[model samples]
Target: MTRSTLPIWRRIEFTVLLAALTVGGGIWGFVELLEVARDKTAHSFDTRILLAFRTPGDPSDPIGPGWVEEAMRDLTALGSTAILLFIVVTVLLYLLLDGKRRAALFILLAVAGGQVLSSFLKLGVERPRPDLVSHMAEVYTLSFPSGHAMLSAVTYLTLGSLMAHILQRRTLKIYVLSVAVIATLLVGISRVYLGVHWPTDVLAGWCAGTAWAMLCWLIAHGLQSSRARPLD
Candidate 1:
């Protein structure tokens, strides 16, 4: 069918499929790179690069061990509460302002679904964390995909996208999105810097989380559009 004649749901499905393919391909490429890094010669090259940028557990800088420790403590302290608050506030805002309850539902589904997927992937992969340094926090789960990274991407990016739709100024919207993206990146990096996760773990988390978030957005948008359209 022609573009104009094609159904909206079908277009949305096509877009979602394309997004899945792109994310899957990127993840596969990253896995291949990790495999290459496992080789002795290739491993040495990777190790040198990592060492060049390594911050040797200094307690001085804001991004150093002391800061990371405090941040992790704060994150753990506010973890469940923050998630609950995020859900409650988003739902209330959507209901009161735009009556877009679907947006709030989408955010919950995306983040929760991503969490489940990340957990399953981590268990299946069963990758262990690096033992090169002392971990700042204790963790017993598999380390292939960082939960913090996945949740950060899902929560921050989803909220940022929703905010973008509501906000008027293009620059303000872009700034919000940029901050979300940067925060997601920094949180993921913090896990690695704290010696709690492998670099590959964070990368995989970001890819999977982003893909799931986009999928949820596509679904929510498609539903909203359908509701707006007149009956056949």
Candidate 2:
């Protein structure tokens, strides 16, 4: 047989190594962001970035064209509780029907755990929403780590990584992962644009969400690797 020439990073062992690095880096970044958030003077940069999206005199008015405002609301919904529940339920049903019960359970636990973690983190930080700008959307929860940003990253990345695991081709795997990353990023940006979350809040969300998703992936990978039977 011809020798395989795939790069070292693409191999299973190296991929797991990279995933561990991602988890560690994400956790470190989140801790740093959390410290900055607690310091009033350190948050000036975050305030400046948040203000950039709004008009100088009127914090209520975002700078983009009218359509952009509407689009942002729609984008923000991607991370809403109702929409995320629907997505998880639908994916779980499909996975179950396809006889991939392990994957289905993985999805449920990862997303639900993320939801619980997000709630607790918000409560722990007890950070109030930015009063400097008028919120374009309604929000009732404490702000620090944004729920939208975190949930979107956790949900999309978990689903994407799971799908990539079973896919046969490298290109298709990359495509699935790219879409997941893009969706996560867009949701985070939409939160800032809509004045519902501080820039640092979204940053912390991304870091924590990414780390959680990768941890779940690492667990699933270990289990699957140990089994001789295919996941499906």
Candidate 3:
């Protein structure tokens, strides 16, 4: 059936299923990419780019802190913290406003599920963070897909979509979604700029997270519609 003709519940279910498959396929593709990245030639290319951005520059020197590098490092840290706080507060606000236990549970699951997926991807890739410069912030995990980039995408975009659903003003809904997209983009850029994650890592994070967020939103919307429907 055409989309307009489909029942709301069916449409939601289809969207959610599509999202899940998208994310699952992306994750599988990412894993294959990681395998390719493990090759010596690929590793060299990745390392070369990361080393190029290192701080404290001397053309001959491998390591030194430049002003630009320092600034980028600080920016990344700031962006990371800000996004974290925003997600926490937004989830709490949703819980308070919705007063539906299921809504809160879905939000929690989406965020937590994203985090877990990030962790697993990091381990699977086992790529080390850049060591060319003194790191501005301490980090100990393998850094294939940046956690900050992924989580920011999941939390911010998911909330934005939900807000768009509930809010009456279309402009306001667009504004909310714009902010979410902007935040997610900046966070991913910050990871690359700080020399902590490879550009590809950030890109993969953005892709994976976006897919996951869409999936969660579709599921949540379906649940909400089911609840709203009158008994047959």
Highest-lDDT candidate? 2
Task: Estimate every model's Cα lDDT from 0 to 1.
Answer: 0.61, 0.87, 0.67
Model 1 ranges with Cα > 4 A deviation: 1-98, 166-168, 227-232
lDDT of 1 at 143: 69
| Candidate 1's TM-score | 0.69
Highest-scoring model, TM-score = 2
Off by over 4 Å in 3: 1-32, 41-71, 78-86, 97-100, 131-136, 227-232
List, residue by residue over 98-133, the lDDT tens digit for candidate 1.
Answer: 665555565566666766776676675655666655
TM-score of each: 0.69, 0.91, 0.71
Candidate 1 yields a Cα-based lDDT of 0.61
Query: RMSD to the native, candidate 2?
Result: 3.5
- In order of TM-score, best first, we have 2, 3, 1
The collision pairs in model 3 are 55-64, 55-65, 56-64, 56-65, 56-66
Model 3: per-residue lDDT, tens digit, 1-232?
A: 7988988777665546767777787677666656654653445655566667543353223244576556656556533646566766676676667675555666666777877877777777676776554455567677777777777787787777766656679899899989988888877776765666766677677777887877776666666668552111
Among residues 3 or more apart in sequence or in different chains, the pairs in candidate 1 whose N, CA or C atoms overlap within 3 Å are: none
10 residues in a row with least lDDT, candidate 1: 37-46
For residue 71, what is the lDDT in candidate 2? 98
Which portions of model 2 show Cα errors greater than 4 Å? 1-12, 40-42, 228-230
Candidate 2 lDDT over 66-184, as tens digits, reads 99999999999999989888988998999899998877877788888878887877777867888888899999987889999998988999888877887789999999999999999
